[model samples]
Target: MPLDLNKLDHLIAVAEEGSLTRAAARLHLSQQALSTSVRTLEREVGVRLLERTSGGVTLLPSGAALVEDARVLRGVAQSALRRARRIGRGEREMLRIGHTPAVTGGEVSLLLRHVAVTDPELAADAHQRYPGELTAGLLAGDLDLGLCRGMSPAHGLARAVLGEHRISIGVAADHPLAGRESVALADLSEQTLVVWGRPGDSGYTDLLVGHCRAAGFEPRLERSTLQGTPPVTHVIGTDRVAFLTEPPGAAAGGAVRVLALQPPVFVPLHALYAPHLASTNRDAFLDAAQARASRHA
Candidate 1:
């Protein structure tokens, strides 16, 4: 039998939220309506789909199978919708793009503008994801290109290394480091450093720590892994300092200050994509992006 898409989505939502009321709220439906839908679906399937108690609703054995099936169905539905849209627009290549957290706000907005102006017919959708996600996306054929930092491209994907984007110390306006044109890793030796990560990637974190050690001082990490741009904001708001991206103008508020690393540390930014991407119109996309970033920088 053909699957009931509506019921499948609702069931998955209910299982995830653990309460019909909350699931209904998430799905933007009345609790009564959601309950009625679930009941109707149970009757059609001729089995109890859930075991509900004050604790929360858990899927029954049969319901668990249905929920797994629902997840597959959701993926299929999303793929179908994307395919239909592409076909309708007569776009040949569905350019799925992913970028690192490094490319955000002004950088992304600017590149998108240039992409649209240069190739409006190109079916392009870009997402900001972690470095690992970008590698996976390119390998899975879901993404045409990724802008990432440090990480090498996955096999079958070639990389064009762009200039490194430096990681600088962002401090509160009144902090001591704010007065310096550039602060070396050694300068932060005794300071309480708000480094990013819980069990953060050693690859990037070690770079920072190593720099300090080389300068004959060790960094005392105050916080583990601060993802994206939050480290910049977090340091400015709370402690004396933190590690952050070097995009000076993107500092969250006027209260923040960017202190260049005294010895200067820069993170590698690479344009990664399928090996074949260099040949086609996709190569033009990179050229445009490079030009845009150059103009702004």
Candidate 2:
């Protein structure tokens, strides 16, 4: 038999809330009624999905798997509804794109211009989103494409390397390295490297660190307290140096100086999207971006 979406929603609520009583309250149902619904669902599925205890409830392996699928199913349903409404209203198709902060606005605009060159009629809406938000939006069908740097694609999404950006160093104007025309990787061995995220937590940070290690130094890392700021700005008030993609002299009111790395390091620009969805506009954009990247290469 086909699974009931409402029951799946109830199970998700229980899983998220961690207590049947709380889940019932959130669902605006009595605890007994909610319990009965879950029991019925279990019977229908012919499996025990939850472990009951005085403290709360815990999902069994089967239940945990189902909950993960349930969220994706919910997102798919919402996406279908949205598409249907748009089609019913005779609205033009708009490609929605979300990108993480690692991808600058200038990079996005350049890609859009490339798309315009090939497909002038394609319309796109792009915005900045946190990494998690970008993944969730893509899975939910709210975003047709996601652009990021060194981000691993979440389950149900496909990723492609559209291009790469040369990495540069940014330091405060008064810093020792600021007056240099180019800074070598070894020159930064004594300087603290400022990064946006922790070493193990961010793939981009880990990749940069790996480069430093390759240059014979384990970098001294400092996590920037200022969130969502440009990479160059991270070194504005500190003596540390930051890895940035900005061109030389592209700093906040000249507070920082951008210098070329001696042995150039490049970070990949990746594009992610749901593989199950068919979007010609997304295909067109990816094709154009890849073509431009190949020409530049």
Clashes of each: 7, 0
Assess the local accuracy of residue 297 in candidate 1 as a C-alpha lDDT between 0 and 100: 61
Residues 178-265 of candidate 1: C-alpha lDDT, one tens digit per residue: 7667777777877887754422453346566666787898777776355665456766656567777655533566678887775667
Residue 4, candidate 1: alpha-carbon lDDT: 81
Q: Which candidate comes out best when scored by lDDT?
A: 2
TM-score of each: 0.56, 0.90
TM-score of model 1 (CA atoms): 0.56
Query: For candidate 2, which ten residues in a row score worst on lDDT?
Result: 226-235
**RMSD (Å) of each candidate, 1 decimal:** 8.3, 2.2
Candidate 1: residue 291 lDDT (0-100): 67
Report the lDDT of model 2 for residue 240.
88
Off by over 4 Å in 2: 17-34
Q: After superposing candidate 1, which stretches have Cα over 4 Å from the reference? A: 1-89, 92-95, 110-124, 197-202, 222-229, 247-250, 276-281, 287-297
